[model samples]
Target: MAKTKKLAFICYPGQETFIEPIVREYEKRPQYQVHRYYTDQQADVIAAVKWADILWLEWANQLTAVATQVYEIKSKSVIVRLHSYEALSSLPTRVNWKVVDYLVFVAPHIRDIVKMQIHDIEKQVCTKIIPNGLDIDNIPKNKVFNMYDIAYVCNLSLKKEPAMMLQIMAELVKFNPAFHLHSAGGWQDKGCEIYMKHMAKEMGIEENITYYGFVENMETFWPGKGILLSTSFHEGHPCNIMEGMARGLRPVIHNFIGAKGLYQEKYLFNTVVDAINMITEWSATTPDEKDYRKYVIDRGWTKKSMMASISKLIRLCGKKA
Candidate 1:
């Protein structure tokens, strides 16, 4: 009989984009047998934990109840993945770290923040920082569009700060009237849509902003822009930012945790005004497309990097036959 290492992933519903890729990657390896369990279904999750050799958790908030059930079943080798928003919001939740063997942070800053919040659990939890990666072969090359168009592809959420992009666009239009902003993502809650429309109207940049809603083809959507903007308050290696870079879009992002060490110092901004100024100046003296693409590719977010980190983690857990 072949050795089988059973893995169960517990994640939120409608998060296929985040979970599917990882599952597909792991499934390709011969030694692994991965099963996904939705946190929405308690019975199914409990069953999965009982059968799994390793349990991988996506969100920390779901850990409390799930951990209790897993402990009752005596589940082994658990890994919890923490994102940026969770670091800010999930601190007060009653989390049981004893059930988890390792905590994965998408960014080092998130790991640092989590350590501060749960200092007492330091001995029980082992933390690892793994940045999000892109499938280089799948990312399409430039799908040419009109020049001077900026793209901001993210969910229109309060945490994403889409309003900051609108503010920056308003400033950019004064000097470059040809500049247009393209947004491609859906709003999860009613509050997001309300805030988004209010910000657009308040800034008088509503006309320049085009909302394309959810995009199914990121390869096509990403390559059609000259610049990409990220003004998020926090993030765990944002997939959009990595996708943008892979597609050859020069990113003009705020100084957030995951992006802090990735880009040049000039790209970092403390305020929206400063971000606008920097992007405007950079746009005027845009580097050659070849050079820009090379810069993004050189940074280690490829499939190899992602797999290496994941494999190392599995080995550390002493992968059982």
Candidate 2:
């Protein structure tokens, strides 16, 4: 029998939700043997790097001293997954870009921005654009469209612009009293928490807003909601938008990088007032739910689409069973 190829994934401790599911899916195949190591522990991380045929790291900030040690020890290819937060600022000079064989971006706009910032397009590094994918077969279908509720699933961070979402909901309440907003996801910084609480109270929309922090099953919270809103300043193909659309919820997103190609003019907004208008208009119109579901499934959220991309990436690394 042929030996299974060993693969090591190095990431921060709390990122298991994002990384684990993908790793688990890949490991199901008989050709691969996967091991996960948290970068928080230096010695264990280094040991895992030395033992694997491939190194996969998540987030630019999470790459610390341990990441450098991995590059030094491992002759295997290195792949870094870049998110929106990493592209917002400058990267450290000692990142050892030469060690990276491939850099994957979740959106094309993010890839463009990073290339402009680095200014070395001629470098030997390979860049791939792979948007976040959802398990469409598992997502429950919400047959009924309840116009009373709207939901936003993301971390309550400043860059996510939760304050703007609160303001939009505040204005929406006057026009439609039954309008309710549901929020889920964790808070990273103190400022984000304080701002979220202050805005909810100040806008007098606290009664209508339901906070379900850090949910494990977004499928339950996503369905039955009439419209989904994303007011982020930036994003690398947000999972929330994809998941919401899969559940037959219409999406109203700000004019950001990843959203440009996915939605139409009716769903795109440039400002708070624009967002309010767009949401209100979407809520009023009763579009065909089947059409919405079909759109999401066709655009890389289906099981087949995700597996094809993953297989392509694995093959690109020159690994064999």
Q: Per-residue lDDT tens digits of candidate 1, residues 158-208?
A: 788776777788888877877888888888668878877887788777788
Error of 1 at 313 (Å): 1.5
Off by over 4 Å in 2: 68-74
* Deviating ranges (above 4 Å) for candidate 1: 63-65, 72-75, 91-93, 143-147, 290-292, 318-321
Q: After superposition, how far is residue 157 of candidate 2 from its true place, in Å?
A: 0.9
lDDT of 1 at 289: 57
Report how far off residue 209 is in candidate 1 (Å).
Answer: 0.9
TM-score of predicted model 2?
0.91
- Tens-digit per-residue lDDT, 192-229, candidate 2: 88877887888788899988989987667766788888
Best by TM-score: 2
Q: What is the lDDT of residue 62 in candidate 2?
A: 44
lDDT of 2 at 233: 84
Q: Candidate 1 at 213: error in angstroms?
A: 0.7
